[model samples]
Each structure stands twice: as structure tokens, then as C-alpha cells.
Target: TMDIRKNKIREAVQTFENLEHRMEPVATVRGVDFVNDSKATNVNSTWYALESMTKPTILVLGGVDKGNDYSLIKDLVEEKVKAIVCMGTDNSKIHEAFDGVVKLVDTANAQDAVQASFSLASPGDVVLLSPACASFDLFKNYEDRGKQFKDAVKSL
Candidate 1:
């Protein structure tokens, strides 16, 4: 009985998918991968997402600012991100943080953000939605934000 249970546990672990809104892969459209990490509503979470990136990234960032300090991810953004699509009500802070470091575009919604990020991407590049701020400003929640991102990617 113990052996059977252990094997089942191992199988479950092997088959387990990442949680929704947390490093979820939405789709790959025209060779560009789209990832939804909308659960990353803090600098540290976004940092981990950026740290794991292996390809050039067009990052979709922003939402409801919770007094987030962009400096924490500045170096990582400079290193891994090729462009930034700001999705939020107020994006002046995002622009201020990433303007000279990378190309920045402002967007007010998920579809626009995804489209802008896609436009900035090339083959083998990734469009990552790892907003380091709360989603209340534009979305009901992180899951809602992630769902919108997925839907937009599917539409492409």
C-alpha cells in the first residue's frame, strides 16, 4: 500500500501543471511565446520571473501600483527585456523606470498590451506578462488579468 501511494504521488508530481496566473504559458503565436505571470504583483515575484527568462523578452508590466519600487528589477529588465508594454491606468512610473533602459509603450488593457508586446517581439522572443503591481486598477484580479492575456494571445 505504501509503495503504491508513493508511486501515485510521484506520478501526480510529474504531471502537475503550474498554477493559473503564475508562470502560465498562454500560447506561441508566430514563433513568439506568450507567458502569463499576472500573479506577480510584487517586485520580488517579477524578479524571479525575469530571472528565469532565457530568451529576449517583451515584458508587459503595470496595473495598480502598491508603492512598488521598480529599482529592484531594473538590472534584470535591462539584461533580459528588449521592450516594455505598460498596462495600467497610470504608467508614468513605469515609463520613468524603463524609458531609457528599454523601449516603453503604454497600454490601457490586456488586448492592447499583448498586441504591443507581440509587435515588439521577434522570432524566438518571449512576451511575458508579469505585472509587478495589483490588477485592481484594470482587472478584477490576477486570474482575470491572466485570462485576458491568454484570450488575447489565442486571438492572435
Candidate 2:
């Protein structure tokens, strides 16, 4: 039954525009792409997001700790991530996970995180907000988090 829908789904997807947030390209400042992937509420989802990155990335992560095992994206972070900006109330786990693997920094909110990511990025780099945890710790929901990300990018 699922397979029967494949062709139809493929056709629809081929014509579909990316929805706001969830890897949506918010803006391009200089040569950097600011992507809002605030819908990533789990490590697996973040893994996919990181895997899709073509240029060096400054990954903005953090939110409510979900007992996420960072090892799932360790190698991806190590290889593609140039720096990390933590935007949760608590970021100990984020530090522990990427301390030595990449440059890690903390931010009080999405705006701060976006600014920090921009500072860490260069031309041809990307700032990705693919938080691997829930948005409740920082915003009303994933949409709220994504909106903040977009607003910050627009400000820059």
C-alpha cells in the first residue's frame, strides 16, 4: 500500500516548495546560507540535516535536553560543522558532546545564537538551526523557534 503511493508522492514532492523552517533557507548574507531547521526535535532528524550540508556549517543547537545521544551525529559534526552555538537554558551536554570535536559556544536565545553563528561563519559557510531537542525550553513551539531564527537572519 505504501509503495503504491510512491509515484504520487514523488510527483507532489517534486513540485513542492520547502515549507517555512525545517531546513528552509531564511537568507543569504554575503555567501553564507542561514537555514532554519527548528523542526528537528530528535538526534536522528539532526543527523539528516547535518548530512545534507554541503559547505562548512556553524550549527546552532540546544533546547530541552531529551537524553539525546550525541554520538549519532558526532562524526557529522566533526566533519562538516565548523563551530557550534548552544541556545538552551542548560548546555552542559552540548559542551560535553562537542567540546573537543568542534568550537563550542553558548547563547541565551535564538537571536544570540544566530549572531554567534554569523560571527563564526565565513563566506561559503552555512548557519544551520537544527536543534536536536524540543523548543519548549526556549520558545512556544518549533514554529516559534523557526520564526526567531528567520527574524535574526533578516536582522543581519
Candidate 3:
């Protein structure tokens, strides 16, 4: 089993999003829904982010697929994602899995990915960069990936 305390905290955070669904929609705030889930090399983290969203979402997904099974987040993508912008050189699998389920775009670098995501997202929508794979594909590590995402978001 994993760390109980950490699991509890995650459960608590997810529960809050679940609860937020009940809140009535008021005014929509226009901002990029930037997410830095570059540590999700196993696919589960991407699934968590997708499941947690209550707003229109643009998913920025890419990186080295480590035996990834994209089907795991398929339904979540169809339900919450407004579009899918990839940030990797090789995106054959990501495209094959979600080509029709959502609009698909690709980027060779972080800047393009962020810009494309911003374009796909609108007010009250989220531009989520939850790469469900390894960061070594384009970045030195997960921290680098996260920092790039934050910088791009701040620039927007």
C-alpha cells in the first residue's frame, strides 16, 4: 500500500472538487487552466486530473509513453476535455486514442503547447498540461517540465 497520510490528503482534495460540482455557476473567469502533472508517467495522475475537473478543459498531454494505455483516460477525455494539445515529438498513440473523441493538436516544444492550449481554452475553461508519460522526452526532468508550464502560464 501507499502512504496513508498522503492518500488521505489526495482523497480530501478530490472530494473538494466533487463538492464544487454542486456549486451554482456564477460569472465565468477567463484564465488559463494550466496544470503541471508532468510526473504522471504511469497514466494514473492524468486520470486523476481529468476526473477532478468541473470546468471545460483543454488537455496538454505528451511525452515518452511508457507502455501507456491511453484507454484509461479515454472516457474522462471525452467527458471533460474541450480539446487535446500534445507536447511531444511522437504523438501517434495519443492521436490514435483520441483523434475523434476530441480535437487534437500537437507541439514540438513547451511554448507551442501552451499557446495552443490557451487557444483551445476559453473563459471558465482549463488548459491542463498533465502529460501522462515521461518528461525525458523533451525536458531534463519533471521539475523542468513543471517550471516551463508555469512560465508559459504566467506569460499568458
lDDT of 3: 0.77
lDDT scores of the candidates, listed in order = 0.92, 0.91, 0.77
Residue 89 error, candidate 3, Å: 1.3
Q: For model 1, how does the per-residue alpha-carbon lDDT over 1-156 read when each residue is reduced to its tens digit?
A: 999999999887756546788888889999999999999999899999999999999999999989988999999998999999999999888888887899999998999999889888999999999999999999899989999999999998
- Model 1 off-target regions past 4 Å? 1-17
Better of 2 and 3 by TM-score: 2
TM-score of 3: 0.80
Predictions ranked by lDDT, top down?
1, 2, 3
Which runs in model 2 stand beyond 4 Å of their true positions? Answer: 1-11, 14-17
Q: Give the TM-score of candidate 2.
A: 0.91
Per-prediction RMSD in angstroms? Answer: 2.3, 2.9, 7.0
Error of 3 at 110 (Å): 1.0
Worst-scoring 10-residue span by lDDT in model 3: 20-29
TM-score of each: 0.91, 0.91, 0.80
Residue 27: error of model 1 in Å? 0.7
Model 1: ten consecutive residues of lowest lDDT: 12-21
